[model samples]
Target: MLGNDLPPPTEVINMYKLNQIGLMRIYEPNHEALKALRGSGINVLVGVRNDELQQLASTESAAEDWVAAYIRPYWPQVNFRYIAVGNEVIPGEVARYVLPAMQNLHNAWSSGVLNSIEQIKVSTAVAMSVLGESYPPSAATFSQDTAAYMVPIARYLNSIGAPLLVNVYPYFTYVENPSDVSLPYALFASESAVVIDDGLSYYNLFDAMVDAVYASLEKAGAPQVRVVVSETGWPSGGNGNVTTPSTAQKYNSNLIRHVLSSHGTPRRLGKSVET
Candidate 1:
């Protein structure tokens, strides 16, 4: 989705079907992609553009219109799932608008023609920067600047029983400190437990990073809220000496196997993760 070189949406859907990848997340409503998703039976996580937050927050009508144009037409056939209100907007200029936009969108989704349709939960996607502390997962808390909005957003998601979408990138963390963060640990190739926090063992960076966000949610007074790792992947190439196709394949291969299992994480045992 990051480049124009990708296959047509129809072919992409076919590829997903052939590979049995049941879930797909598109950053925005690509009409053709949505059309292509019709009857594909692939549950989709769709996003609301960050720029559209202000307008959607301004009026419930805007959210309603948005649903009419984007969602109403192909819902059942498209298998619409989560609707991300904003992606990584917290701590940014429009951070203040996210919660309101989510509220409005949720209201619109719950009170219109779309209302009768099963819930398509509204939540925001956040990056690792939102965490104030991350080393010891149990000690993680939302950074001061982001907490003002993140806490409320977390609570709102809890109120609506929606899971928080997190973008977890061990690559960024590893690249920043390769010496401290071993490549095997970052890529989920660690053969032994690397860290122990609050008596919970962590074998890989992905779980640690995700557990950090979970801990932050606990402190945010939304401990009951679940987490959805909306995005997580390693670079296939580009970084000098660091990026390689084999490494990328290894990381993703292990990642998929891990998440697809019912083992979950040490923090949330037996609960399968939705990647």
Candidate 2:
């Protein structure tokens, strides 16, 4: 949906099935997409727009209504997996409403309307900027300003048996600090280990970024909570050499291979979670 020339919802769903894409995460409640997803069998992680956070946090009923309108109707047919309350709204003004939105949405979902199906959990999506210190992965911690919001949200997600959704963009990290962040590491094309953190090895920037979030969660007293990568990609042609087609294809293919492999990240080896 981010592109200017995307096909219609039906065509898009067909392509997903044809390509065997198991899961999808949308940025907002796209009714056309929801309708097309019914009986499609592709797992879905739907997002609530950042603007919707204030309304959802304002009242429990508002949350319930949102679920009713965007989720309930498509139920088991849509294979709803998770409801993201907000995307990258933290470290800013509306950060105050993120947890409240999650709480209200959780209450609405657990209010017996959708009690029969506990699989459709509620959480929020955030960017890597929430972490103040991310290098060395293990030593990562949330920034002072964002901690007030992330800490509570982490605990809430842990309590509800839901995973925190994070948008980890190694490409941006590489471009921002090309002098330090190498292209091979950012694309997961490195042959040898890159960073060694507390006996854990990291060969790619993606793992480092994700582990940083995990470290932040643990520091926030929510070590048990999981993380789902809500968004990640390499630009196709926006920039010059760094955003060429060759690099984009390599990054996308390597990412898929890395995720499908049996071995997970250094910090979470042998443990699997959705990407």
- All candidates: CA RMSD (Å): 1.1, 1.2
Q: Pick the candidate with the highest lDDT.
A: 1
- What C-alpha lDDT, on a 0 to 100 scale, does residue 169 get in candidate 1? 92
- Measured with C-alpha atoms, the lDDT of residue 105 in candidate 2 is 84
On residues 37-129, what C-alpha lDDT tens digit does candidate 1 reach at each position?
Answer: 999999999999999999999999998899989998988898888999889998999999999999988888787456676468888899999
On residues 67-183, what C-alpha lDDT tens digit does candidate 2 reach at each position? 899888888889999988888888888989989988988888786858876888898889999999999899899999798898989998889899999998999899999999899
Q: What TM-score, to 2 decimals, does candidate 1 have?
A: 0.97
- The reply for model 2, stretches above 4 Å from the true place, is 2-5
lDDT of the candidates, in the order given: 0.92, 0.89
Please report, as a residue range, the 10-residue window in candidate 1 with the lowest summed lDDT: 111-120
